[model samples]
Target: MTYAITQTCCADATCVAVCPVNCIHPTPEERDFGSTEMLHIDPKTCIDCGACADACPVDAIFPVESLSAAQREYGPLNAAYYEGREAGSVTSGPNFHAWGEPVFERVLPSGFAPVRVAVVGTGPAGMYAVEDLLLHTGAEVTLIDRLPVAGGLIRYGVAPDHPSTKKVQDVFARFHAHPRVRMHLGLDVGKDVTHRELAAHHDAVVYAVGAGADRRLSVPGEDLPGSLSARTF
Candidate 1:
């Protein structure tokens, strides 16, 4: 009844943070996380609690019993990640502690003061930054985005066919209305609020604004008017 991570895995590591048994592999803390194509579940250590599946943003995790024919291979692929490693080792994953145990102190010192932060994007990068600041520190976040809505890349960059990937917006949206959060949408930074103004108010400012550029087709008419990139179209 163990769960497995399939090809659709986005490697956002959301599941890794919630797995009660820490069965997910190549966690963000691991060096291989950057190069790993996708995350896997260690079937041997999985308690079949279905926590990873529930936490998966892209719906990449599924129960072994429910895997389709094409996805069934993932069951073995997941188990192979832990084949040469022991569960309790550092490289093997975060299984050294007991299930649901706190591996590290996530709370800040009681004497720490709450600092205001201005994040200049409402996309995944901006929201993820906000999430960490709010959860791990006593920082007050001021969420700012040029668009009327939050969710930068998650809202615009992801294709319509990949609805599962969009589910992550729900995760990021949770912090938009937090007690310590102040949202400012439909406001351009340079035009409406200057960098100095943000710096003057907040102790820190994070610019998670992602870059978007059109790919060159190298065609003669590619640069002509009325032509737009797929991202823009």
Candidate 2:
């Protein structure tokens, strides 16, 4: 029997990055990914290689035979998710090969008034949002960050020895200079600017604030005075 993804799934799609076969449905490329309740494995296409299970961070996958009685219904549920849907193109993994040329088209309306958008963090997500919006629309993006520097983890969290990793932030440099993008640093949103004030000043506000917390350690003496989180250390 094939493996099935059960109810505890977080749907981060890291599993898709490792699967050799393109057997998953509503992949990250799909427009409905953010809205979909969960990702499903196609019973007909799954090779049973178990790579998706290995990549899953939450350990949500299980072999159909190994499923608990309560999860037995998931086998049919997974299959039902693929009903009437065709298999997707294999865009990832070592087996991936060249595909046909992609078509370019203009999706947004032409000559629309510039949209003033306040993006509430300057990490990779906020930078990507600014890049995508500026590429597609005449949006004037304002990046806001509480740190004096613009980049979130790229500027502070990443280890300094990993210069190559930090160098990738160079790609974001051009965005800082983009006429459409405005950078505001060392500004706490709730303290200096209220949500109401931001709403009144811009059409939309995007929060890319990185993870709010860290995993707590369970070891003895973990609470020692010198202890520091990776973000702080």
Cand. 1 TM to true fold = 0.83
**Least accurate stretch of 10 residues (summed lDDT) in model 1?**
88-97
Top-scoring candidate (lDDT): 1
lDDT of 2 by residue, 3-78 (tens): 8888766576767767666676677877878686677888877778899887776577888889999989989998
lDDT of 1 at 178: 99
Which candidate's TM-score is highest? 1
Model 2 clashes, total count: 0
User: What is the lDDT of every predicted structure here?
Assistant: 0.85, 0.79
Ten-residue region with minimum lDDT total, candidate 2: 91-100
Model 1 misses residue 195 by how many Å? Answer: 1.0
Q: Candidate 2 lDDT (Cα, whole model)?
A: 0.79
Instruction: Report model 2's TM-score to 2 decimal places.
Output: 0.55
